[model samples]
Target: MRRDSVLQIQHSFTGPDQGTKGTLYLVPTPIGNLEDMTFRAVNTLKTVDVILAEDTRNTQKLLNHFDITTGQMSYHQHNSQSRIPQIIEMLEAGQNIAQVSDAGMPAISDPGFELVQAAIAANLTVVPLPGANAALTGLIASGLSTDQFAFIGFLPRKKSEKKAFLDNLVNFPYTMMFYESPFRLGQTLEDCQSAFGPDRQVVVVRELTKKFEEITRGSLADLVAHFDENKTIKGEICFYIAGNDDPSTDESLLQAALDDMPIKEQVQWWETHESMSTKDAIKQVAKQTGINKREVYAKYHEI
Candidate 1:
């Protein structure tokens, strides 16, 4: 059954022709500075039969600046369900459409995802044209580790819900980026301090590629204090927080160990010396000695 299922699988190629189906171009608009708009994005927008915009008025300003004369249709969170079927129909009718958000990439925090999913399900050619993105722009300049990162766009509005959400990522080992409003910056900083601790490094990037762009870096506590004192922070923001570098480190688990101790002996030593339970000793020994917990458990059990 597995072999038969694998044999029946089909692959969709991005560049290949899909008969009469029209292409859905995921065009990215500049987050801030108009100069950051890519040439390809402009050309695609200009040539497409129609443009699906998050806000036609906001996107109009961008279109006007680029002298793009393409017509726009509103596709936002509220109307996405009603609009997706129509969009898929247009694509099926071979009318090339371009989707754009107010800023940055469409679908990053927007309802453009539904339309994209509809297009793909209809076997339409979906092409993405990269341009300015606030998260990546701020991340590169954030002074945080870029090797591995997660884009956690906007937390829940409710304080309790937001705190619980952040609590889950306390030991997350990748740099995290978040989009935030200037109004909530202070409160959010306070929350970060509580979840990740006061000493966790954070960078607050405001108004990227704009005339009044600002990048502030400090510990979560310092940022909380700074925002409290300043009382006014304007423009769009990208919040970058450093992840737990040594997530395994626990002060209570620290103890002297014999250099040549076996994995099982190490677990036993932690149990005897630190007065920990069998389960806890295995966990602590795994952390202290950089061994996998399951491997330590198996060794200790003589499995």
Candidate 2:
């Protein structure tokens, strides 16, 4: 077994030693605009022995734009497992390496986590440089609460699964941010409306930092209608939803309590407490319990 060094404390300003293992730099690339790239990031890339790019083809454009001549090795999701050991060996051999995703920060819903973990376990120093992040960029301008927020990356693809996944977070009190594709924007909005209710505030930011950047803010229902009418949503998206502030009326808790009741009783509970119509109440019950809507409807109507 290879014996690793004890946990070595890192100080950002501590200069590298010729005898020590090389540092792993987690550099953030611009999400859209190239100007967002930091001076330090550029210098680091220039100085590093090599770069581990998520997509060599995509990163080549950025490197070309910046006139960076560093060689790159592909390190993405498909190849991370195989690449990690090799990367650690490179670091061990005192070859400084910088890891960059195609855009934004490394390891935040990107390919850097496994590599970072491996580097740390091997007791090598890991350094991070701050740069563009779609979620943070959207949140500051979103007009939503930023004091506390959760970064929920891409969600489940299927409609029922998506709804069920969101249903679990309905009562989360901190602001929530998510990344989504343009193709599924409409259905995602619909699912948000069902899970979080129509009145909840939301902000949708598209094509951020680009010429066609747009930030739309309104209630869930309002944005749902707006996007539905437009029908041609495009660009990278980062969306924010207001969190549940009313713990007294925490719906998830209420639903959990209702779990003890019969299906008919659950439907009735939503109607009486939420002032929902019979059909709407039945749908709500079905969504919460993962029961088939038809089964819930039949149970509600049974004598």
Candidate 3:
């Protein structure tokens, strides 16, 4: 390395916020409770020339409470492409900006990573401030092994894709965290029950750090039963589950396969693998699951 170039790389003392190039501060807002907002985060947002919010209305209420009169511009997934160049131009013009999500950290199941990468590519300073995160909040209290864990924000909505995604994580040997909507909570739980088995434990953290926050722990079977009766649950759910340590038994493997597949496919499995006739497969399914053959027949007809 050249001696003069080596000197330029050393002894950089100025904070990221102070630079000839305008900085993009990735500030984290409170996930639920307003008190969770950090002092530094609020100060950074106040000092920046403009705030780029996932939703202007939601961020406006938060800024009002803090009495931060900083201006905010809408920057979400739909408009990210056009806005990135505009933001970059502002940064190049030495206009400091702070990017924030509706809740929690920016870019975690939210839109901000693209802008951050753009800033980096343009040699602009990017600063990140830590505050609240739903995944970590649920993990610390999940009572599961958190020494090494994976954060899978949200699964694919399609049944086929969701099953494939969960199948890939079935044998992950650490705790797993996921964020899911309350509307699809039951079906998502059923998918998890399929992948992790009925005996695996799960912890559900709802509306973390909020007034009506709730935390429930139980086996996969227990949760499936609880959610089945309460189909109209509300609030965001932080799902934590224990990963597999050993290979699944034959019975559980068969159940997992059945769990992911439609009834028609299961009937075909019975016909092909168990050497049963079509009528025999239907009869066996009804007898084994206690679900009437009429309903099973209806599903295939619909398909």
Candidate 4:
């Protein structure tokens, strides 16, 4: 659709409160389909004095679609720091403003947390609007255990840092979720295999809510093989790694390994000899030493 057609819609929204101008509205934009925009969110954007957008051009399309011409300013990762003070000042001045990311909810591994934090510190009212989210959608459709899960967002791009992050999370008892771009999906699955073990169960959800949506479930080893053989992968990918189901490891043996070498070294020894999850091995060490498993994972992962 032409950009002007969307803007035409933005120019038509009305009934925004001109009084009580200091409230901060957190509006969630659609992750994929533009039709997902909620009615209340649309009205809020239309009524607010200003809209803080991660990408003004993208938001402009939404505003134009809804005929919402409320003033808008760019508030993204690069500019948010400098812009935050101004926004706070405006809010304190009683000028209501709305903040939005390009997709999904803002401040969710996105760049709006500081603004929300500042607003709370300054005693301003903050409102959250429910909307589309890739993580939750992927989790639900992934067919992986989701009663409890951790959203790790995007993993580090650096090989060492990413591996360490994965290694440290092996002991997490809850299911885990991570975002991965198609470009790096293969490497990410390989790293998960190394950190969580090849036999660990995982589900990959891609292109959610789009025409090509797909959900793949299998062991990490199977995924690694699929990605390795495929020439290319497309769309955003969410990785859900199932927690280890084996009973906790033996503490005395884990401690013996830890006492003589480093934690990662110990985990490697136990994993190689006892065939245990790195998390289980760490738990065993923590059980013997009366230390936290988290600390053990950190020490071993060295992150």
Off by over 4 Å in 4: 1-21, 247-303
| Predicted structure with the largest lDDT when compared to the true one | 2
Query: Which TM-score value belongs to model 4?
Result: 0.76
TM for every model, in the order presented, reads 0.79, 0.80, 0.77, 0.76
lDDT of 4 by residue, 1-303 (tens): 656522111111232433444788889888777888999999999898999998899999989998998988999999888998999999888898899998888889867899988877766677788888889988888777888888888999999999888878777788888888899998889889998888989998988877898898999999899879983788778778888666235554346556778667766776778898988988876776777889989988898
Please give the RMSD of candidate 3 to the true structure. 10.5
Ranking by lDDT: 2, 1, 3, 4
lDDT of every model, 2 decimals = 0.88, 0.91, 0.87, 0.82
Candidate 3 residues 163-249, lDDT tens each? 999998887888999999999888999999998789999998898888889998999999999989878788879999897778677
Put down candidate 1 lDDT per residue, 107-158, tens digits, no spaces.
Answer: 8999988887777666677888888889999999999999999999999999
Q: Looking at candidate 3, what is the lDDT of residue 63?
A: 98
- Model 3: weakest 10-residue lDDT segment is 4-13
lDDT-best of 2 and 4: 2
Find the 10 residues in a row with the least total lDDT in model 4: 6-15
Full-model lDDT, candidate 3? 0.87
For each candidate, how many residue pairs have backbone atoms clashing (under 3 Å)?
Answer: 0, 0, 0, 13
